[model samples]
Target: MHSFFVWYRVNRDEGDADMVIRGMMARLACRSGVGGRLIRKRDEPGLWMEIYADVADPARFEPLLRQAVDEFDVEMFIDGTRRTECFLAGDAIPAICA
Candidate 1:
């Protein structure tokens, strides 16, 4: 399974960004069959992160996530680019850990 961690800086009002992000997450869950969580730095509310855990198919999920972002105009609320990182299960690469 692949897990996605996306982080970005919110350029607009935190409350408005939060509302829009929540709605976008809901749409993703319905359309992509993957649920997501939104969080932020404790001291820096403008910096937000979205966590999508245990994604069985990143090929399908990543595009859907991008589509939803465009559909919801999520860029309007953010500053700079959204940085996305993906990870694999530790056991998937056990050879490297030995």
Candidate 2:
């Protein structure tokens, strides 16, 4: 399974970012069957992250995620581009990397 972590820095005064993010997450869950968790960085005002774990189908999830971002215009609330990372369990790592 795959897990995705996406982080970004939001615009400081954007009070509506949370609402928009929640809406996007709902849309993503409905469309892709993947629910996400949103969190803020400790002691950091503008840093936030969204985590989606146990993804069995990254191929299907990725495009839906991109689509949701575009549909919700999530970039307007952020200072820069969002950064996304994917991780696999330690036991699932490829033999070539071991």
Candidate 3:
């Protein structure tokens, strides 16, 4: 149960941003058995993505991340911000991340 937070600086257009998000969503949805969301900035100009996963072993996601990069076609221009939080439980969750 490793939790990951990913923030992506993306193109201002909503459609372009979805390309990266959709791909990551597909893989994480299946592998982690968890769902994610796409957040567009209200006052700022970026995209934020977050995920929760039941990891058998956290290291296993390394390759998956690479796969997501390809599947999402995340180019160098899209800078990713990530933080790995402690493992998850039902109630300790933050609705922002949910």
TM-score of 3: 0.60
**Model-by-model lDDT, in order?**
0.92, 0.92, 0.61
Residue lDDT tens for model 2, 1-98:
89999999998555799999999999999998999999999999689999999889999999999999999999999998899999884565566763
Candidate 3, residue 67: the lDDT equals 70
Better of 2 and 3 by TM-score: 2
lDDT per residue for candidate 3 within 2-56, as digits (tens), equals 6655566765555666765676777867875656666656776565655545555
What's the distance in Å from true for residue 6, model 2?
Answer: 0.3
Give the range where candidate 1 is weakest over 10 consecutive residues by summed lDDT: 89-98
Best by TM-score: 1
lDDT of 1 by residue, 1-98 (tens): 98999999999888888888899999999998899999999999889999999999999999999999999899999899999999986655446563
Off by over 4 Å in 2: 91-98
- Give candidate 1's error at residue 44 in angstroms: 1.3
